[model samples]
Target: MQLPIDFQPGWAPADIEDASAHRFLFLQGALVVLRDGDGARLPDAAYRDLPIGVLHSVGVLDGRACHMAELSDAELPEGLEAVPLRQLFNRLPEALLAVAGRAQQLLDFARSHRFCGACGHANELFDEGRARRCPACGQVAYPRLAPAMMALIKRDGPNGRELLLAHGARFPGVIYSALAGFVEPSESVEDCLHREVFEEVGLRVKNLRYFGSQCWPFPHSLMIAFVADWASGEIVADPAEILDAAWFHIDALPPLPHQITIARRLINATIAEVAPDHPALSVYGAG
Candidate 1:
């Protein structure tokens, strides 16, 4: 999906050596450091003196060079606090949030692929692109991404068009969101969506329509979302995957996902299409 920030991705180290460049500093555990002020922002020249272990170029943002730096220790230089990247959802602009996610994923990739799996040799950054090279075995490793599918099912109910939302077994609190699962080997995204829908809720769906995608950095995942119509089958929430599953009318809905997520966008867009004058539209600030 399109974000509101102006960014052009690049990986050359020489392009981001300027002291005034935007730097996304992260601790050992992928915690981002933000300047303490009116609103959180990525530290710039003020933190250029921190002991950085590694630095990776993350292209350009708003016509300025951007980079992601990994701090060797948790020591802060004062006026800065470390926070999880996910916690900056609404606090930072959408463009900045998206870029931060990219920075985190790139850092995670570099940290995890420090050694070659094939020869157990130390790996070095490849000069040509975003990859690690094993000089001993000629093995090259690139950043890995896991693709997942999110499906929002809808059908005409006695009251109106209702949506099928589920509280996943792993979900925190009582938040109910669209059903989602990862794509398995040798399976397409569409196949994964259909299989996940039936496996989680024991229901059939049809007329799949692509919604959009987001680069989720809970580790590294590309979430592809879609909307579908329920064809048949009764609600039988799988005890293994779903804590609860049901169809809710537009007016009466449970707590939804955060607005930054593609799941929320999918639900909002579908609701606006099905019920243009829905009061929920104004409540959600539907675009």
Candidate 2:
């Protein structure tokens, strides 16, 4: 996905040091408030008043230095609220949203890898890119992104093509989305796709055409999406992971993921392909 603003991606501190203005995303425990409740707000001056401290450099936004930091309860000023990271998706612009996700992953990396696994020594950010290095043992740790596969299965029906959508046990209400599962160790993404589909819905898929990718920063996941033709198998919703599964034509579909997500993009692309003149395809257009 393209960012709304130009962001010169880098991890080196020197890259952002010369920037004229600085914007920061602050995380209190695990949330950052994008807006205030009663329409009031916390200005950048709030952060500027805090004592001098090191800021994690995210990237330059329109020639200004954009940074992030993990804060404690006492660090937050009055009238500010901390919301879950996921809530910022629709609140911030596309470019700033991307930066927020990056900050989330970076903070996760920093918190988990504070000490070197090999030498048990405190780890520090490397001078250049995003990495943590140990002075004692020379060990380096980079941000870890778990790769996951999402498959949107489609099949030829008596009326027209239908998409196989499922509701996971985690979701509330009747929300349905493409089947997804984490890529196992030593397993290819395609292999993970087939295994997850068969295990979750007891189906076989073919003609796996790679669709696209998205960085889902709920925790840390790289979503690799694909459009696959449902080859065979009865719809069997695995009680463990899937709550329900069904095939729905584009004209009669269920609730889908957000427009910023790859699952929604895959569905939209498939709808456009099956029914070029369908109006639903344009309903959930890009953000």
Candidate 3:
């Protein structure tokens, strides 16, 4: 459960944060603590007093809100569960956690949806409640996920093996990600993947292997990732989205993201570079 570079593992003890759309355990009051990236300890006292909400799940422990598993593997350290947040998503039987996670996502959406686009009336949660509504403009607002793409480009390795990968143009140094982009209007997921690959790397692909999916809440995103083979063309990094593109030996890969994301898990596993798993759910608050 190693978290990506920009991940922060934060949980609102059931008592500390209120779980909307129905109460969730993550919101219950408990002494939760975290040892962030800087190796600093974040005590429960630091956040216990904030207004009951889900924003605590955001990246505050460090530069980014990483998954809790990024912190440790041991469960119940000194009476606190030292675990990763993924376990919540992967382990929990229901979308209760996902609901909370989504609530955290929508919690954010609601903040931004407060303003009215047409009549300029403040929005309120109503419609039995459909979610949110504007008092003046009669505009109903709801949580949304921006459709995005995730693809793996294929090429022939020096040894005759296939090399596939996706790269984002805005990555750090020497870092390329899986091919992904926002699914445009009137286009299928596969269509967007094809167009994005061509537009970004100038390569067409086939046999799009559907791996899995994850609901990314960075301002709301639904990440649909796939594993595709080389259809035709050469490597060309689309300046609009792809910073640079290349093929790896499939065995020797570059820096990859954490298992919390489908984008990372898909490509890494495709190349058999599966990242290690860490513990889920960590408790750091005091007695």
lDDT (tens digit, per residue) of candidate 1 on 1-287: 24445788888873335877777888865555565555688787767778887677888888887788788877787778777876776666677777878888888888789999998999988956589999999999999999999999999877788999999998878999999999999999999999999999999999999998988888788999999999999999999999999999989988988888888888899898978888897786666
Q: What TM-score does candidate 2 reach? A: 0.88
Error of 2 at 42 (Å): 8.1
Worst 10 residues of 1 by lDDT: 29-38
lDDT of 2 by residue, 188-237 (tens): 99999999999999999999999988888868899999999989989999
Runs in model 3 lying further than 4 Å from the true structure: 1-47, 50-104, 127-130, 155-158, 272-287
Instruction: Compare candidates 1 and 3 on TM-score and give the better one.
Output: 1
Candidate 3 local Cα displacement, residue 219, angstroms: 2.1
Could you give the candidate ranking by TM-score, starting with the highest? 1, 2, 3
Q: What is the lDDT, from 0 to 100, of the residue 24 in candidate 2?
A: 50
lDDT of 2 at 210: 98
Model 2 misplaced stretches (Cα beyond 4 Å): 1-5, 14-22, 34-43, 50-53, 74-79, 127-129
Ranking by lDDT: 1, 2, 3
How many backbone clashes are present in model 3? 42
User: Which candidate gets the maximum lDDT versus the true structure?
Assistant: 1
lDDT over C-alpha atoms for residue 191 of model 2 = 99
Report, for every candidate in turn, its global Cα lDDT versus the true structure. Answer: 0.84, 0.77, 0.53
